[model samples]
Target: MADKVMVDNQAIKKRRSFREWKEDTARRLDIWSRKKPARRKFWLNKTLYLMMIPYLALFFLFTVLPVLMSFFLSFTYFNLLEAPKFIGWSNYLTLLLDDPIFIIAVQNTLIIAIITGPLGYLISFILAWLINELPDKLRAFVTLIFYAPSISGGAITIWSLIFSSDIYGYANAFLIKWGFIREPILWLQTEKYILPIVIIVQLWMSLGVNFLTLIAGLKGVDRSQYEAAAVDGVKNRWQELWYITLPNMRPQLLFSAVLQISSSLGVGAVTTTLAGFPSINYAGHTIVNHLQDYGGQRFEMGYASAIATILFVSAIVLNKLIRKIIGKVGS
Candidate 1:
């Protein structure tokens, strides 16, 4: 009786273990089977996938590869002439701790950003609104005036007038004549004035095109909505404008706002053209200018790549902040 009981206990334990192992094996097989179909389907679309190969290759080549290379380069010291020796964040550390020019550049960039970002958009919005109210015939001419500066602003002649570094340069001559200051202000060379000058120029250059875009947006607004508001005893032009025009032009407003911010951030070419990098006391060095200093002047390809990475990141952060503000206002 004891032996029979022992044999029965052993058989019961064996059966339970077998069942457990079988169930585990079955579950894994089932999972494998399910995954296999997905894999097969993906492979079956080989031709379609092959069609995407070129775009994917280009994406990796241009975008992903550059980003990865920059990230790697940021950890190294490579001047494009020799091997890249890994410095392990020494470059970034030095930038944070000991780089006086970098600190000044950051300060100048922030100042210009604060000045031009909102002011440019606000002025452009006002201009656009005024233009939108005009008759079609006059509107074209006004738009042409506003946009011409932007189109021509990139020219060397325009830059020369603004930043000639000469006593009789256009801005200096005009300011001196007005007795704004006794001496001819070195607009580009002076540390105290370079950033402000750049901001003013940026504002002027951005006014027309952005304003025109806003005007088009305003014109697209539903006239019936305005009429209905007026019929409801809306008080004045200001109220109608506040309620109808701005809300309706949200998309264009957002676009112009972004453009203004981004352009201000990228105000390097003009700076470099007008005031050389390390602008007096390093007051006019923006990230873009910094990148150019490395990429072009020093030929430090790795350092330049790192600077480009930094600029890219800064741009994204700036856009996010601007968008967030716009969202709050729109809401």
Candidate 2:
């Protein structure tokens, strides 16, 4: 009886000690929680937080939710009007194999990206440099002319005049006037010509906007940096641009490149506007167009979602790679 009593007493004591320790721990945690983030630290920035709420809500609603939904939808077949049904890798397989237009779209997109990415960037920088050198009034006028296309990037009327699939189209008319071609060419109809036509349109459309972005970057660059480079015997325009201007403009350049690349790869509207749906011989059908063909028209939502997912992944990978390259070059 004595031994049993002693054992029970020891057990009770251990339980009591454990309970005390847990209570102590809880009290400490409460104190730490109360003490760690002070009221002043939070309330002092209340206005700033309140100001951020609308943006936060908007981001959550539009950007964050859509991305999450799209990712989820990639694994499911969801027509907008119907319930989503799960599919596997079938959509991806079909895209790679059965879809002939997918291949064409990929080729056209890459071609445009390759041609325009470097050339457009160079043109913008040159224009910005020239604009900076000019009188402010003249610069503004020039800037306005260049920026006109961007204001109407999606205007059918502007594109119709240039890419009119007719005998009297502006481009063909000009070419004929200049004795460049004997015939009004079916520019967007043939695969050989479609990609080039897209590139040309993109080049024209891209002018003022990129120039403006580059100009902003240039304006942000410290004048002292250029003066110092000049003092250090930086001779000509190219050297100044290479050493000072390009380095200072790295962030803006990268941002612009990202925007251009994403836009170029998804070359849907221009082709659609100029060539009509499915494009001439599917020559101008881009990934975005393909998605439209499947998702929007046929209501093959799952397949469309898969295409979007693939494009998203490709963009992420390409952006990461470009950023890495820029980091090395900028360094």
Candidate 3:
């Protein structure tokens, strides 16, 4: 009976201790919440905070939350029907070492991005520069012509018709008329021609936002700066372009680079539409297509999320690199 009473007393003391710790923690947290600088600032600018809520909510819902969820999902094994099970790097290992089609997709994606990305930027800038030289009305007309291919949703269909395997196809007819080859070439079907044709179509589509940005940037350049450059013995058009124009257009150039990198890396819709999804031995297959295959067709959301995370990281790295290069344009 004495031992039992002692045990009860100890139990009461232990419970009281726990209760005291809980109260202390709550008090500290309350004090910290009141003293927090961010909380104070938020309340100070209540109207601005209120105004930002909608944008913040949308951004979190669409961009930040999806990315975070995707990153988390990358390490898991998830088929849509089942719960995600943590797999611990197996997906990445398989992607890197075991998957031949993924290897092909990566190679194809890199090839397309390397060739089309810089080339598209150069061509867009050049076209914009030339158009900038024209009278305002003519410049607008020419811009429309170049930009039309990009905005036109059915442009790929037109390209398909032109590159059709039939002898009646425009490209085949032209080639045969010129005696370049006796047979009609299967532009999309043949692996040899697939990448080149896709690149061509991609370049055509590439002139959308970046091209417009270049035009705007060029227009925004002060005419007096060119006059000043001329006075400073900037003897040639090349010098003027290299030293004056490009430096002034850094913001637009940066914007265009980011746009081009993302578009080039994420080139699934066009390739799939033009060449078909798998694309004949995966010749025209890209990382984006691989992601689509896993996510959309196989319902392998985990692997798809891994691919997305990779793409996101690559874009960030490439953007930083391009910014560094662009930073040194004139200097």
Candidate 4:
């Protein structure tokens, strides 16, 4: 009975100590978050102000101003030929209630974003991880092979031949010979096939700068850390990745995630190149396509601005969510 009472008292004391430690940590965190930069530090870094001036000016003109203007114009009705007349929520309301194509575009964009974003990010990271330690010449050759498709503006010509609708086309000829189907599939022309083909092409071309930078990050990880981890009994590849590699690669991972989300959300080039802008039955149409339709072809500047604003906001939200998720890596 005495031993049981002593054990209960010890448990109570331990709980009290834990609570005190937690409270102390909370206070420290509050203090850290609330702290302001010292004036001395700012003055010490005064040279950075001059260095940033050119970039800040360009960014304001090209990035900040355009985003602000787009947001402002979203509430107005303006064609290229006329002055912008304030239409309040009419454009947004129309987007939600009236425009079936807009709905389709949103759905298609989401589908592409949902599919391509994670897949591209994951595949790029995996490839980077695998290639990081290869022979220098071989790694460079492989990187060039993976990256060339993205940089080559005329890459569609190659895909065009491959996915050509005629029986003489590579895919059709192969499929026919294999007895998959008697008829040649209209891969790019048909609504059903257009999106899938675009997804494939996009995936094929997805590894651009993101892959290169991630490989660079992996090369930066200290070799000693891996040796230390091995000593700590982390022999499995998955365990090494989870315990060491991921934590070390958080910045690169987050950056790649941002690029993937941005590219996926803004995926129109593959669709447009393959299926044309309007696409058959609007099946492969995306938000980017819609924006280009209004902003480029129709000259509906206000409506297009609204579309741009929506895409921008979506990208921002997705990036924030990605940051949150990636922040927990290695923790």
Candidate 5:
């Protein structure tokens, strides 16, 4: 504890263990005896800077530029027929105060996100962990089975068959056979059932890139750390995971978190595919759906921009909050 440590966020770093303490002490003690490597000035690293130009240029041109334009346009009313007219928060005002469907959209979006985000995250991690421990051939086969639904172009076709609004639908057939109901229920059409069914489908389709990332993270974890942790009084797998595994996999966890949250919040295409766009009195309406409806269907670009801005801000805030929480993982 003699060495002073400075932190913009102290909770980000867990308390050091005995090995870490010893290593730090040894490094400090041997500092003067070791010859230090020479550091290069900024201009000397021009080659590395040049290597990053393509990616940086593409990111700014596509992502940054679009976001900036959307933010600027959110305050104006443009219907694509004429010049954009500045309304100075009128769109936002209408969104907050005047639009009832917007409120419903927000409510449904939160409901979907709240149910799916953490559930999907946990499910993916657990499944990935199990998969990572399997033998190579079996793992490859199993990985394809789990991952196929996410990448396959015919995913909607598969789901539609299962939940089709007819006597022949798999779910309805199963239920009717068991005498659960007399007739086939309109699983996708009903207001009360549509959102829940969508959530179930979302969870079923949750094993995508996030699942792969966790598997890679689990594989990348240093086995030596686990061995050292066990010798240092780690009692079980749970303890090792809490102290050693998670801390080492922090970067993967952060990346997966962003994907999971984005997937959960941006529930547009799947909702439209499974349930209709504005399904049964706005029961399945989400912010993304609302934005598309206004922007694409109504040609109200300003209102659409405002909706997009709200979503953008919400995602940013949620991401920051999650980053802070995830920073405290090992602590």
Candidate 6:
């Protein structure tokens, strides 16, 4: 009977050991099952991350680093020949209180932006809409015509001849024949006419990438939606546009608005080219011109950086405001 008890105890111990092994196995399998999806997802996205590295690197190197450096430099007083000296808010204070030319630049920049930005955007959309109604071939031709002036680099020189101060200039001769004025007007030289001429040139050049984007957006809109609207008793084209077209093209509209704002506010190159760098009494001088004056001419790197930071902040704020306004368009 003692021998039988010993055998029975051994069997009991064996059973307990088996049960423990089974439970441990199950726990390990449960843990692996939970972790498998995350492992698979990491491997799946690994290729995408690798592909993105180059673009991210270039963006940081060129765009992000420069902006950061410029922001840091804004707080210092640095000339090109010397190291930066820390001066807190002095540049900004001087700009706001003492610099009358900076104020003029701000005013001119705003006037140009307010007029050309909205007007040019509206005109581009209208032209695109009208062209979209034509036959495909004709639409293509018209689009080329409207977009030509923008791409034709240095074509603005022709306007110089047209508005020349010479008595024999086209504008002067025409006006003289019509008895509008006694003599040739200094379109670029005189302060009174300078702003108007620059505005005209800017408007002429404004139908650019935004116009093309609008045309593409108009083309991409689904025809079936329009047909369904007609079935639903949508009365006219105007009603359809308000409800369907505008909502469908919201992305393109937002993109165009951003491009327009940037282009409009950064209107230095054209202004400098048309009206001289300083212009007459800085009549056409913009914020960009003032930036060039300090950064390029005077070598006051810190002041230039401060000006750049201000413009950058202004652009960001304006973009946000525009985005908010545009967000209400389709709703």
How close is each model in CA RMSD to the real structure? 14.7, 11.9, 11.7, 18.5, 15.5, 12.0
For candidate 4, lDDT tens digit of each residue in 47-152?
7987999999999999999888888899999996888999998988887799999999999999888988888888898999888768999999988888888777
Ordering by TM-score: 5, 4, 6, 3, 2, 1
Each model's TM-score, in the order given? Answer: 0.73, 0.82, 0.84, 0.85, 0.86, 0.85
Q: Which of the numbered candidates is closest to the native, going by highest lDDT?
A: 3
Model 1 is weakest, by summed lDDT over 10 consecutive residues, at 151-160
Task: Give per-residue CA lDDT, model 2, range 34-153, as digits (tens).
Answer: 665775465557679999999999999999998788778877778777898878677788888988888877777777777876677677778888788777788888888777777775
Clashes of each: 0, 0, 0, 0, 0, 0
The lDDT for every candidate, in the order shown, is: 0.78, 0.79, 0.91, 0.88, 0.87, 0.89
For model 5, residues 1-331, the per-residue Cα lDDT tens digits are 4234455234335445556778887666456334543323334464788899999999999999998988988999999999999999999999999999999999989998999999999999888878887998999889889888898856966776788889899888899999999989998898898888888888888899899998889989998988888799999878887898889889999999999989899988778888887788888889999999999999999999999999988998999999999999999
Tens-digit per-residue lDDT, 1-331, candidate 6: 9999999998998898899889988676656556789755655576798999999999999999998988888889999788889998998888879999999999999999999999999999889888999999999999999998887788777777777888877888899889999988888899988888889988988899999999999999999999999999999988888888888999999999999998998888777888888899999999999999999989998899988888888989999999999889857
Clashes of 6: 0
C-alpha lDDT (0 to 100) for residue 251 of candidate 3: 93
Better of 1 and 2 by lDDT: 2
TM-score of 2: 0.82
Q: Candidate 2: global Cα-lDDT?
A: 0.79
lDDT of 4: 0.88
Candidate scoring better on lDDT of 2 and 5: 5
